[model samples]
Target: MSTTAEAPSSSSENPKKDTEENSESRLYQLVKNLTILERRESSLLELSKKRESFPQLAPVLWYSFGTIAGLLQELVAIYPSLSPPTLTAHASNRVCNALALLQCVASHPETRTPFLNAHIPLFLYPFLNTVSKTRPFEYLRLTSLGVIGALVKMDDPEVINFLLTTEIIPLCLRIMETGSELSKTVATFILQKVLLDDFGLQYICHTAERFYAVSTVLSNMVNALIEQPSARLLKHIVRCYLRLSDNPRAREALRQHLPVALQNGTFSKVLEEDPSTRRWLSSLLYALGGEQYNVGSNI
Candidate 1:
């Protein structure tokens, strides 16, 4: 016969160890759920190629992906300790959804106005700022720029100012200076949006002489545009320079490049033909020399 041992009394024992174990288990399960969601999202992306073949399915798929993205964003926001890698991964996926939506809306002008009216400066702003700072995961930067490209079409001055004041200009400049071809292309799109604003123009003027290093970046973007002849990228760079050189000092700094840009003819023609581009050029030329250059006529 063995002596009976009393079970540990709950009131006499520490419950902290059990609580900690429970917490760890809960965290593990949450992480596992998130990982599964992410894998499912990745699998969905592989179906994009088939989307074109089944045109009717594209919008439904985009909506589904977008819903998943929204859920992921909400979950990550709730779980602050979910890890940067996880947040970045989810953000990148959401950005892809946003970009696909943007392209869809862009191709159909009727859809564009409503989409921008609904989302600009609200969903897109924080999303851009979030992805812009995600290091070691620079692909997000490209996607952020795509969002910016879509938002730039909005005729909202406040939105434009927000982008410039948030240090997006310098960030895009850095990426344009150092990133790969595709990255630079996207950065240029975002930079174009910032440069369309008055604050962006002032920033460039203030920093113009101090950062001659940026000249090389500008040159590289120009050369790339020349090589690829991407109308979108070319239009963006021209618009950026037009806003940037709006100040007298900045105009002088950019004077060296003006002749070259003008000689290219495509940029100048676009500026002349496009109402928005024309407005910026007029403002820039007026700032530089007080409306004496006949710039408006060319525009």
Candidate 2:
């Protein structure tokens, strides 16, 4: 009776491809669940404390960078249109979870490259812009800053170039101006790392608007505090100045700001007491002070 019913062809099936597809699906599921874990306020702090839980998600996140973008986009999509100050708990939870995932993703060296390659700054800027505009939402603000800190550690060329092209420096200054102490610490860390590169310093020096922001924020920070951790942050600030002043345009920028710092004895105060921080600032002070300020004793 003619042919037997045609059998579905096993020959056309690819076992290896199926296995990979299944594995990817499993990894994605893991990310989704971890994100869910992040949203519950009761579990949020617990999740952060458990570092062991992070590696499970890291490999998948590193390998599935597109998924990270998609997750962030989806979270933003469902978020309330209200400002950060008035964000509903639901919206805040979603934003918190998304940021936590980003922080974890950015933290690992293996994962960091994929994150940078994925142009995370582009995906993240919308959220960052919101956080910058709203000074409250402490958790959201700190988490956003933490993500920036993690990216700074990567020091990737593309990431640095992207930062230079954006208002990120201004954003960091905004945090410094109004955010919590932890946030200010993170913001300072961001500027310190950003200025570590010649390109970043040059960009700040050449761009009048950016130069103004950097100078003003740093000046205020030094005026505000200089002890222990604050002193530590000042060390980074002085080191950045040293690098910035090395460039002709940046030196001019520094020279103009130096008078204000000197007028307040901000530079001299550090030199008098904080021996640990004194070393980094002395050269910068001398450079800014020209030949009159002897820094030879620092050696």
Candidate 3:
């Protein structure tokens, strides 16, 4: 009876061991394929997304393996094609996949600091700076922003400071001014995050030229919204204005140049269901409440 019982237990153990070995084999294939000269970017993206389900995956891919370096290598291999804008859709899609993996690394707390320390994000600036409206280039720009956006989404002030040292603001401002609505919204969200940081707010308000640059993009965004009217985009735009209001100089400027549409109720119906945005709009007005002023070209 004891021998018979042990036999069934051994059979169960065999399948569990086999399953573990199979999983490990698969992971090894994914990692090793990363070193291939013609690597599969889509495979990297799949593994990166899997990190969401397995909390330890990103750290392991980032630290114990060559995931970040592999992705960067894959990205740089295609960098030379951007200047004259000869990048094909196939190439853009491949690089974007690699970017998705890099974004995963940027977002994970354990790997985020080192990712910044290496200045890995600088590799992506060209993509962000691209003016191509072509779908391939647009997708590339948006994916690259995802990496930067992940970095800023963290609560660390260092992330904001590091980005400030770079030309992140100008690049984002350009995207805010010209990218598609979805891209514009993402760029605005990044700016909004930076402004929420005390140092970021001070930095923008530190110079009139800088302040004017920001306020102008915001004004243009508001003008566009008046005609097209995107509630989601408006939400981010309002949050940016509300955060800027925390700065005294910025607050006064806003009061003097707050968009007429905002004060005159163009979005009253738009915000009917968005209580949080409505509250933010109200608070923005109150922050600038001491006086009512006219909207003009000065912003």
Q: lDDT by residue for model 1 over 1-299, one digit each (tens)?
A: 78998987767266888776665554333323423555544443533333343333323322443543543354245233223445557655654553454454433444444444554334433443333345424555565566566656564565566556555666677777666567676777666665566665556566646335455567677766655555555556666667666566667776555534433343555554466655665665555554455664545
Off by over 4 Å in 3: 1-6, 13-21, 48-51, 64-66, 290-299
> Mind giving the per-residue lDDT tens digits that candidate 3 earns over 1-299?
35543445545557878986776676667766776656566466566656455455557667756656778887887778888888899898888878877887789899899889999999999899899899998999999999999999996899999999997999999999999999999999999999999999999999999999999999999999988999999999999999999998988898788787777778878888788888888778767873452222111
Candidate 2, pairs of clashing residues: none
Candidate 1 is scored at a TM of: 0.47
Better of 1 and 2 by TM-score: 2
lDDT of each: 0.53, 0.65, 0.83
The deviation in Å at residue 24 for candidate 1 is: 40
TM-score to native of every candidate shown:
0.47, 0.71, 0.90
**Evaluated with TM-score, which candidate comes out highest?**
3
Question: Which digits, one per residue and each the tens of the lDDT, describe model 2 over residues 136-234?
Answer: 356666777778788888777666777767668877887777776777778788887888877887787877787777878877776666433355566
Regions more than 4 Å wrong, model 1: 1-95, 98-139, 178-182, 209-214, 224-232, 257-299
* Collision count for each candidate, in order: 0, 0, 0
Q: What is the lDDT of residue 71 in candidate 3?
A: 80
Lowest-lDDT window of 10 residues in candidate 2?
37-46
- Rank by TM-score (best first): 3, 2, 1
Query: Residue 46's C-alpha lDDT in candidate 3?
Result: 62
